[model samples]
Target: MKKTIGRKEKPYMLPYFQMEEDSFVITTWHDGQGFNLYTSNERYKTLERLISRLPKGTIIEND
Candidate 1:
């Protein structure tokens, strides 16, 4: 009897951002005194840049 090898499934990547809305405001601070507004596309790019700058093994909390 020959044994068949099964293909391994790809590991699932945990979602760091919930980008469902049409527009996204990247960040705001000091009661809207200071803010950085970005479009949906820009938001994604900014997030990617921020993530890349972080040190390895950095765990992001999504609460």
Candidate 2:
């Protein structure tokens, strides 16, 4: 996959992720101040480990 980011007037486009199977994918983007992660998988133990590592204020969303 690919993405467009940065200022709307001068956005930057780049290749983002790749997957061969049906498993979920994880990709990150910069939000100016820091980084943000978007995930399509919800494997419990993986999430547990991820949550354990991030700072407390990180926002997590599920579908």
Q: Quote each prediction's TM-score.
A: 0.26, 0.31
* lDDT tens per residue, model 1, 1-63: 333356555555542555666565556767955445455554346656656666999775533
Give candidate 2 misplaced runs (Cα > 4 Å). 1-26, 29-45
- Worst lDDT 10-window in candidate 1: 1-10
Runs in model 1 with CA error above 4 Å?
1-45
After superposing all C-alphas onto the true structure, candidate 2 shows an RMSD in angstroms of 8.0
- For 1-63, candidate 2 gives per-residue lDDT tens digits of 334375345545664666444344444445554334444445423667677777999886644
Residue 11, candidate 1: Cα error in Å is 48
Tell me how candidate 1 scores on lDDT.
Answer: 0.57
